[model samples]
Target: SAVISQKPSRDICQRGTSLTIQCQVDSQVTMMFWYRQQPGQSLTLIATANQGSEATYESGFVIDKFPISRPNLTFSTLTVSNLSPEDSSIYLCSVAGSLSYEQYFGPGTRLTVT
Candidate 1:
């Protein structure tokens, strides 16, 4: 199992602001995933960031809006661009287990755009 941590457990930002969320893993991992969970909604994959390569964003997500960076095997970052009230959601950082497909998530950074 891998332990991941994220910054800013929660934040309230004004519209049009951007927030950069950090993710750190206790151990090296083969893959790291970023997800967004809207209020009362399921997790949505934003991108997959693996070491030695560029992050891959999902169909609906573009790199310009949600730039991602993976500096090493145990660290990654996700930045939300052009924030809006609709962007308010719980951003979670996750990594899958070595032998299991199950993923472990960070406590999450809850963002509220006001």
Candidate 2:
């Protein structure tokens, strides 16, 4: 199983600002993912960040808006750039466990835009 932890559990930011959140894993996992969960909703895939490759973002998302970096097998970071009121959400980092198909997620960084 994979254990993931993310930094900055919560933050209140102003408009036009940016925030970078870090994720750390206890084991060397193959794939790491970033997700966003809006208020009262399920998680949505933001991008897939492999250990040595560029992150593949989902449709409706762009690299300039959400830049991701996975420097090694067990560490990654996600930056939310050019923030706005709509950007307020719970950002999470997740990784699929070694055995099961289920993905384990970090506690998430709750951001509020003001």
RMSD values for the candidates in order, in angstroms, are 0.9, 1.0
| lDDT value, candidate 1, whole model | 0.92
Lowest summed-lDDT stretch of 10 residues in model 1? 96-105
Q: Quick one: how many clashes does candidate 2 have?
A: 0
Q: Name the regions of candidate 2 deviating beyond 4 angstroms.
A: none
Task: Give the per-residue lDDT of model 1 (tens digit) for 33-71.
Answer: 999999999999999998889999999999988999999
Model 1: runs farther than 4 Å from truth?
Answer: none
TM-score, each model? 0.96, 0.96
Model 2, residue 91: displacement in angstroms? 0.6
- Taken over the whole model, the C-alpha lDDT of each candidate is 0.92, 0.93
For candidate 2, the lDDT comes to 0.93
Instruction: Estimate, for each residue in 11-84, the C-alpha lDDT of model 2 and write its tens digit.
Output: 99999999999999999988999999999999999999998899999999999999999999999999999899
Best by lDDT: 2
